[model samples]
Target chain A: MLTKRIIPCLDIKDGRTVKGTNFVSLKDAGDPVELARLYSEQGADELVFLDITATHDRRKTFAELVEKIAREISIPFTVGGGISTVEDVQVLLKAGADKVSVNTAAVKEPELIRTLAEKFGSQCIVLAIDANLVNSEWKVFTTGGRHATDINLFDWAKQGEALGAGEILFTAMTRDGTKDGFDLEANKRLSESLRIPIIASGGAGNMNHFTEVFQQANVDAALAASVFHYGAIGIQELKKELQRQKINVRI
Target chain B: MSNRKINIAIIDYGAGNVKSVQFALERIGFSGVLTDDITTIEQADKVIFPGVGEARSAMQALKDKGLDTEIPNLKQDVLGICLGMQLMCDYSEEGGTEGMGIFPGKAKKFPVPLKIPHVGWNQISKLKTELFQQVNEASFGYFVHSFYVPLSEWTVAQTDYSFPFSAALAKDNFYGCQFHPEKSSLVGEQILRNFLAL
Candidate 1:
């Protein structure tokens, strides 16, 4: 009877929140800590802060930001982007992050997932996969979805769960920023395929999209950026809409 | 010690988020110490068993330090969180392992169509003890696990998935929550406060 979570993802760059279309044309959103507080007040079940430039900068200010945000919000928060090593995971957790996500690093070094799971526990390690439809198959992409990996999305998700990843955050590159709806077929496939919780990210236009994802895909949570960032759908109103649709959600 | 000062000992067996758990306790105006030392753990007014790892390995770690035997003997009120709660049972399907036997039950995976790891917050109904005192019947608690304790005489609360599962259990000095009270919001904090008051 666990309630389906409504999560707001904040993409961070240079210590500020930003949103972009199709993972490009980034524009400043606001201060991460302030946005986090706002989301928490809006009844967001969890918050995902991804350092979009963590790999490029070769430095991690996300840890300090995580510390600041955790101090302000009581809800669970996950930090991702540019997390490659056990030390990186430790630094974030030590800075008060509830979970640390690894994407590009995990794709390159799969054993790093097992190592982090061992060191920080599975619940603390989240494996993020950016997937896109390539030649009628969901293919994994890396380096901020710029490079396409030959690995199949389903295969990678199973491997991630086997490696003790606590959860799988899957983003469909094709559906991302389109706002038409979630990649229902992809999410459904992954949700049915993986043993762990699957969080559907990328495309979320309105509350109906959330309902569609939760009801049809059976994803544990629905994550969106623009819809939540631009005040298109408030978390409370969205939860009400989901509740109206008979979806179990926290009021 | 004054009634205002509640000394809480968070058992450290090289598993779980001890810092976050400690932070939550301190946030609720309680003094908590994260320790593996037998003396300090035994001396605390209350003890919290927080764990997040494989059952067999964590049990082996506990047995290595002889804490496996010392834990069940403590007279103070004890609370087990997540894997710690699973370990308090008779056995676990995880690693085909035996548990601490504090509760007479076995932990197993939820049947298919209900998912394996019952992750996310779920509402708790059928409340039966002071541990849930003043908490709403529909109050939600954060959970992240694949296995759960079946209904038993020790069960104090129940939640439904593919079937009704034990959300909370209480027997004598031992209390177990499949959910993470530390990660849960106000209701979780109140549950901790109730435990501290006990």
Candidate 2:
């Protein structure tokens, strides 16, 4: 049976792990490579590294950080933030990143998704959408959820699938940093609508929240940052809780 | 050319991503080339058929290049990955297409309520052949597809989804895996390494 995955996302800036509230007011956490190794030991199904800083100085450091993390970890890892061309995807995959997450670049040029998928295979491409509910409609946001696009969440997901994206990582900006719970309603709608596997991100306070997302939304995986980073919830305890709830999880 | 460098030709029938397959082979210290030329493909020490699209379309692409017949006639050891493996079967229910008929089975859809595409990693047990000699029965590999080949004598390994399904098939000179070894991490790499040693 296919088990629901538990992923801990690491936000990297200047070669160090950082966490912020509502995606702002960043504070240094620790070394990216050490943190990645720890997560792998703790039974993380996968890891996501997002380069929070878009500056020129930070870009070089991000590549170095990715190389270092790739050397230390054995599991599959995804690198996102500022990926724009097919060559970029190639370079990252060559550097040992299993998948590349595309956001603003994919939205601007939807054909890039097809091109990258064609060259590297759909399984290597992940379409990350940051959406926020505005006036009861989910609107797509990009550039780390600072800019809103005209594309609707549901329609964009279908388009991404058609473009050969292997999986969709949907992040609810409205619920991010809230710790209330996952946006179950949004995740449920997306899961029912998309043919590909969906990973629910944002708003996970405790183990039960993970259970609610998996049971209510039926997502393939749940992704969280602060909850796991701030020592609020351990990955093992959460998986145990999910297993107790009869959700299929790999021990 | 000495036998030390075993040139592995990966058939590119315009069906799937060939780079990752090439990358995996190279990562395992094996010489691999992606080509559609008949002479180069036939002359290679080993051959790999990798596909990722619809069965009918992939067969059409192979037929257009006349590789539909050339592939089955190859005397060298050949391995098929994912859709490539399905194309080696007698036929596929996907897009109402017939395959190369290298194996005696038909690929069909999984029972409903189990989802169409059986995506993600699952464990393989009841293994056979030296290809899986070092790999444990509990080893897991990544998979993503809607259709699967039914159990038969050719099936050397089995994985459970809605039920226990064929994970690896072997017959004569042909070998096939429904899962993608290139994306399946260390265990997948071991499978490829074993194939190379064969």
Model-by-model DockQ, in order: 0.43, 0.18
User: Which residue runs does candidate 2 get wrong by more than 4 Å?
Assistant: A11-42, A49-79, A82-100, A105-125, A149-152, A158-165, A226-241, B1-46, B53-68, B92-98, B108-116
Best of the candidates, lDDT? 1
Interface RMSD, candidates in the order listed: 2.1, 4.5
Docking class of 1: acceptable
TM-score of 1: 0.91
DockQ of 1: 0.43
Which residue pairs collide, candidate 1? none
Candidate 2 C-alpha error for residue A5, in Å: 1.6
Chain B TM-score (model 1 vs. true structure):
0.96
lDDT of 1 at A43: 85
lDDT of 2 by residue, A1-251 (tens): 77788889998877777754332122323777777777767778789999888677765677677666665565667899889998777667656576789999999999999998767667668899999998889999988899988789999999998998878999999889999899999999989987778989989888999999999999998999998887788888888889999998866
Off by over 4 Å in 1: A19-31, A53-60, A118-120, B1-3
Q: Give the per-residue lDDT of model 2 (tens digit) for B93-178.
A: 98788899898899997776665467777888889997797899868777877789988999999999878889999999899999
